[model samples]
Target: MAEKKANPALMKPLTPSPELAAVVGSDPLPRPEVVSKVWDYIKKHDLQNPQNKREIIADEKLQPVFGKDRVTMFEMNKHLSRHLHS
Candidate 1:
């Protein structure tokens, strides 16, 4: 039997555009890099609401992607997909 590898399409690095840069930063990054940068921003800015640790407060740049003032961490990955391409 042969083992199957993860889809390369899923693993391919996505180049972030200017719209993404405004949210994540000016750094030119791939999808995984963007995710890490976003997390770093969340941590550094202390954007997670205290009452609900899962809820993140959207900043000026993050607002466009989030489509609201707040979002749950669980929903973050799904939201990210909108900005990424295959």
Candidate 2:
């Protein structure tokens, strides 16, 4: 059997917008890494709603990226897409 390689596009480093940079830093990073860093920040700040783990409560720095006080975990990627560029 042959092995499949990871998609190059997903591995490519991307720049984050100013709003996202506040949470994940300004360094160019792969999409997965960016997501991971954002999760780390969320955990560090205890931003996830205890009553509803699927919902994330936005902090001051996250307000711009989230565009609301709260959002579902599934919607986070949708919002994040707007702030990333190659």
Candidate 3:
């Protein structure tokens, strides 16, 4: 049996857009780390909607990154993708 290896693409560092940098910093980071940092930022600022855990309430720093004032957890990835590049 062969051991499974991590996906290189997933580990490759990606540059974040300026808007995203406001929350996740300017340093290049992997996708998972970017998502983790975004979550950390959201948690730090208490951006998640209390009425609906699935919704994220965007703050000033996140407005450009998220485009709108609020976004569903599922839509966050789509928005983040627009702000990330290899």
Q: How do these models rank on lDDT, best leading?
A: 3, 2, 1
Q: Summarize candidate 2's per-residue lDDT along 10-41 as a digit string, tens digits.
A: 88999999999999999999998999998999
Q: After superposition, how far is residue 3 of candidate 2 from its true place, in Å?
A: 4.2
Give a tens-digit lDDT track for model 3, residues 22-82.
Answer: 9999999999999999999999999999999899999999999999999999999999999
Please write out the lDDT profile of model 1 over residues 20-77, one tens digit for every residue. 6676765444676788888998899899999999999998878887788999999987
lDDT of 1: 0.78
Whole-model lDDT per candidate: 0.78, 0.94, 0.95
| Pairs of colliding residues, candidate 1 | none
* All candidates: TM-score: 0.76, 0.94, 0.93
Clashes of each: 0, 0, 0
Residue 24 in model 2: shift from native, Å? 0.7
Which wins on TM-score, candidate 1 or candidate 3? 3
